[model samples]
Target: MQLVEDDKYGWSAKPSSCEKGHAPKEISVDFDEVYKSIILPAINLINGTNLGIKIDCTRGEDLLDGGNIVSQFLQKICQAEITITDVTGFNSNVIFEYGIRLSVRDSLNILLCHEGVKLPLDFAEQRFKTYHMGLGGGNDAKDYIVETIRHALPLLLAEKSVESVENLFRRTVENATGRTQERRLMEVFEPAPDLLVRLLNALNTICSEANAPGDKKVFRLDPKLRDETWKLLEEIGKTMENSSNLSRAIELYELLTKLEGFREKRRDVFYNLNKLCSANPDFKEKAQFFLERGIELED
Candidate 1:
């Protein structure tokens, strides 16, 4: 589509200022590049895991303009029912709206199995109270106002439920304190069997959607969440000896490789290749092949 060319919809009105040597800036319509660079890579990760996302994009010339462009690509071109809304004054910040109902279900299952997960009650309550009071709680809430109690309530529940599970982790880690706070925190609160099952199921769904024919677009996962997921899978494979655990690690590695264009950390892939091959003898040949291939590419 070009500024001068008319689409079936209609040609874009020429800038009136262009008559005075003032031309409207040309916008690149590389929605395909955006999908390949941004959306499709994330979808690849989802393919390796069973996770559903409700991405709410804020409205603005800066955000909605670009968002609409992406949205049109996803909705019209990709033909996926990715919910996009125009909440008043919603800035361009992205929110990872993990389903609270889903979290509550996982929590109930964890309790039923008597499985130990960190689920921190205090942290959950604090998060709940913040949301209940219509205060900002989600990663995106810092920018947007809490409009309705209805919107805030489910968020509070989910935050608290996840926190309750997180608390159990805090107790486990109370003894070990060190420089790798993030890594240490994760090591403390391993996912219960139920949570792992839920995550695996979600990943399966994402992978199916991604590999489905007609359009194989990428679904983006939250960076922190994605890291945590890969960590959880690696831990599970090491400690639990579950087959799905190793499979997920491999799938996530493939997704990360596909995202090479968006990232600068090339060595992480080689590091994971070493760990993955060492951990699973079954994957040794494939891992070795890729490792050699990477060296050749580097050379």
Candidate 2:
């Protein structure tokens, strides 16, 4: 929330004019001063790629559409196609938003560390791009961060426009059910990851073993049990994913794909599983196995 004292980055200025019929490449930034310094640098980096991905940037404050400020910030993080977060300071709000972004979309974020700041041990093995805001490297630090991002985000430079993971996830979930059904489906989200996963997989296993071909129209789980299972799966998937346990999240999602009322959510499950395959090679093969099984069930 701490922005650099600059007029150009829109901290104290009004939002910029929108370009007609043009959807410029955009990324949400987490912290301010360091974030502000990188704005121009990121634009130059994208332009230098000759990839036509002009950069537009925003922090939490820029999204004030008269909604609750906290909710707006969470929504922006949830919705950003790509989010660049400066973990350099370990700001609590920044960390919170970063967690939200991870749960919403696994592979669409770039972690940034400051020159001398110590990072959390949990993400020690995680790769973070380093920058030196007002430190020795200064603008050169921004240059390093941008360059590092471009390499990790090679998809951004591809020939065609790339869809955001958030947009794709939303579309998948929406395609699985309508607005009201989606709301009802998302309501069972208790946040205790282990417990939630336990309950979901327990119920999921029962549904799987109990399910039979040409039996009833479907294996009818108790209505309450069905709703609560999906709800728990949703929160568990997010908690595991945010903890960098993509494989575990994959297991939870795979189980969700087997539940009776959740057949329609198979694509949503696949969407998450596919995103995670990049983290572990075996996940792709595992995903293929689930795809084949789920498809056979439909047939």
lDDT of each: 0.33, 0.48
lDDT of 2 by residue, 31-69 (tens): 344545665556456656764344456665566344234
Per-residue lDDT, model 2, residue 163, is 22
The total of clashing pairs for model 2 equals 0
Angstrom error at residue 296, model 2: 52
Model 1 lDDT per residue over 137-196, tens place: 222321122222224324433332122333332332233453233223233234643243
Tell how far residue 270 is off in model 1, in angstroms: 3.7
Per-model TM-score, in order, reads 0.30, 0.41
Q: What TM-score quantifies how close candidate 1 is to the native fold?
A: 0.30
- Per-residue error for 154 in candidate 2, Å, reads 5.0
Give the C-alpha miss distance for residue 34 in model 1, angstroms: 40
> What clash count goes with each model?
26, 0
